[model samples]
Target: MGKATGFLEYERQGGVLVQEKQRIKNYNEFHEYLSEEEQQIQASRCMNCGVPFCQFGMEIMGMASGCPLHNLIPEWNDLIYKGNWELAYNRLKKTNSFPEFTSRVCPALCEAACTCGLNGDSVSVRENEHAIIEKAYKEGFAKVNIPNIKTGKKIAIIGSGPAGLAAADQLNQRGHSVTVFERDDRPGGLLMYGIPNMKLEKDIIYRKIDIMKEEGVEFKLSQNIGKDKKASEILKEFDSVILACGAKNPRDIKAAGRDAKGIYFAVDFLTSSTKALLKVRQKDKKTDNLAKADGFIDSKGKKVIVIGGGDTGNDCVATCIRHGAKSVTQLEMMPKAPEKRAQDNPWPQWPKVCKTDYGQEEAKAVFGSDPRVYQTTVKEFIKNEKGELKAVKCVNLEFSKDEKTGKNLMKEVAGSEKILDCDLLLIAAGFLGSEEYVAKAFGVELDEKTNVSTQKGRYATNVKKVFTAGDMHRGQSLVVWAILEGRECARQVDEYLMGYTNLSPQ
Candidate 1:
């Protein structure tokens, strides 16, 4: 703790953003970093609770209630408060390998479980993290930590996402030679493609990867193990293999006209858009595979309907708006949450409520109306003569608990069916599990949901010398969880490879 009266003296202050109107014009990061003085003021607000539930990382009511990485939140907050940024950066790096990525994109579970949040606001832990890590970069403190001795063990990590990266970082620190294989053209799997550039700039990812490269981690891009590259070769070559392939198989909508040409998976759309942006930046004149001017699905001058109102759906809305669509609408099956926390929702758990995300704000600003349609769903698709999706047939729903089963379900109101004119339809229904090719190729067992089946707390697969982590084992989750899984999984791999390990979870 920096000062006993620090919490009382300062209130929480989050990072600011660029104007919504200006930010929507291009695919770039919009968040403005807090000034050094402002970051210190926010850091001083940490109460440094005795219990410190923020780092507990427990499962409360079947949901993650705190930082899964169990980050040293209070220590870093105190460090920031005292203007000891290098120390704060060191503490952050002890557990998390990529604070810059998490600081920008993570949901900040630590703040939700903050002790100060019991009565009032929580400390800006996420913003303070962003400040510390960026400060490290500026002050030349962030660099490659080359191990003094080599263990002569070799490890292969399948997938270059957060989990794989973290595992590589720790395992390499143990003096084992590690190589990461990614099917995509670049490293940073989902971070490089699945997420939009505006949320996380690609250069930031490349910068860290450059350092990792210098630290002796080899990255092989466009190498699809078990497909283009043989799993047998990998198994024969490396002493151990860790599968960190993220959950990429998207959950799709299977309604009438689902095979129509205009419909697309949210991941596909986002991935294509990012690829287009990267191509443009690379100045590759090859427009052969670029997303059309009408948007990923040609939303320009056409009505766009997005299904499933999560972060992916919001991204579609923002992307369409930027593409100059005539109109954009989103559908949500669940009822709209309240604006504030309800009486039943006590402190230290995620606030169950409605909050306008950045995309929605941009939509509202441009369209002069909130584009979300809660308690509604697309029943079917209406197609044109060319077999392209022209509109979506939707129905209003009433959410209520069933008397017989006592389960919440949606009931369609009579004569509530309506057709909304649309040209592009995006299904943002989330992901089921990791892709089947690599897992099946490696002969790894899977859970009922198709996730890599390893007992919780143990990341080892059935095959000896094989390990798994991130969405490959846990399904879709936050980046912080991926980092945690990666770090912990690295420890497990180190122990298996050398019969001993020194990687600390804390």
Candidate 2:
């Protein structure tokens, strides 16, 4: 809770974002923070409501309403309001293992469900968290905590993603020797590459990884389990194993010329961009010179089309803009959401409203119009004689609810098809599930959605002494949920290993 009258007296203030026009020139984090005093005032706006829904992580109307990690928003906000910077950081770290990652990338579910938002602007809980975490790093409070007593138990985590890293951190703190195996050369699965550098710099991830290493968590890079290393070997080496490899099998666009050379998955494009950017940074090359990089899918001076209207698609738009795209267009299957909250979509539930992400903003700033075209999808990918992508045949669609099952059905609008010139096509249509090879290698069962199958409300799989969590277990989800799953899974593994656990699941 915050000051009794603070909500009425203060207004919420957010971190200042660099103008899109200037930020698109390079791939770097563009958010500028507020001073300590200003952030405290914003934190003071957290009302002392009897029912603090901001911390109540729950699913309502088939969508997440609040912070899935159940972060101690009120406690941290109160501490920040009182200028107890260190204590605020402590309280924040108690629940959220990595506030730095979430503060920069998370959509701020806590703010959306804040009680203050009922009548006025929500409390700047996300900004307060950012301030606390950054201050913790600056003041050296974010130090490594090597466990005093090392348990004989050893855990082999199969991924270095948020879930895997969180599980490793918790289990390591509980004195279990933890080793995280990553297929990629670098750690931080999605954080490392899938997300672009502008949203989250690579150095931020490496900074936390260094601290984890100091805390006694081992990271084995370039170790692709089930391929390079057998799963049986890991099971024999470690007392227990947890699979946190994220859902990475991207869903493909079904259209003619799908095999065109210029088409790429959104993750692949983003990964390449980040990898090239990091390489250039290491060589002291100009940051904006990613087009000259050898490995990346260069979008400079090329007409680009991105399919899918989600966060990843927006990221592709922004990345293409940063690459100095000749033109950019985004297609969405669903109709455009209302600008503001709908009457049926009440507070305390995830608001189903239109969100103009940073990438879309940058596209508009550069192109003089929003790149998104709602109710549209690619009907065909037209390739030239050279077998490279040349254009896309797109069509508008309409949706209607069925009478019996109450399910929405989509139908193409007659005579709405149109052709647009496109040199590059990026499909950000989301993922199907975890890759099959990993599941088969581990001898784990998969559900209909291709996610690792488990009993209802359980992290344990069919295999004995083996567990799964995060997107690999629950399908595609947020980083916060992945961390929460990892923490909870670590607790389960700890109990199974030691017959009891003192670790907190929350």
- Give the per-residue lDDT of model 2 (tens digit) for 279-375: 8888775556875579788999999999999999999999999998999999999999998889999998887899999999999899999999999
Candidate 1, superposed: residue stretches over 4 Å from native: 284-298, 402-406
lDDT of 2: 0.91
Deviation from native of the Cα of residue 462 in model 2, angstroms: 0.6
Q: On residues 285-373, what C-alpha lDDT tens digit does candidate 1 reach at each position?
A: 44323353324445668788889888888888888777678999999988999988898776677888897888899999999999999
Model 2: colliding residue pairs: none
Backbone atom clashes (below 3 Å) for every candidate: 2, 0
lDDT of each: 0.87, 0.91
| lDDT of candidate 2 at residue 501, scale 0 to 100 | 96
TM-score of each: 0.96, 0.99
Best by TM-score: 2
- For candidate 1, what is the TM-score? 0.96
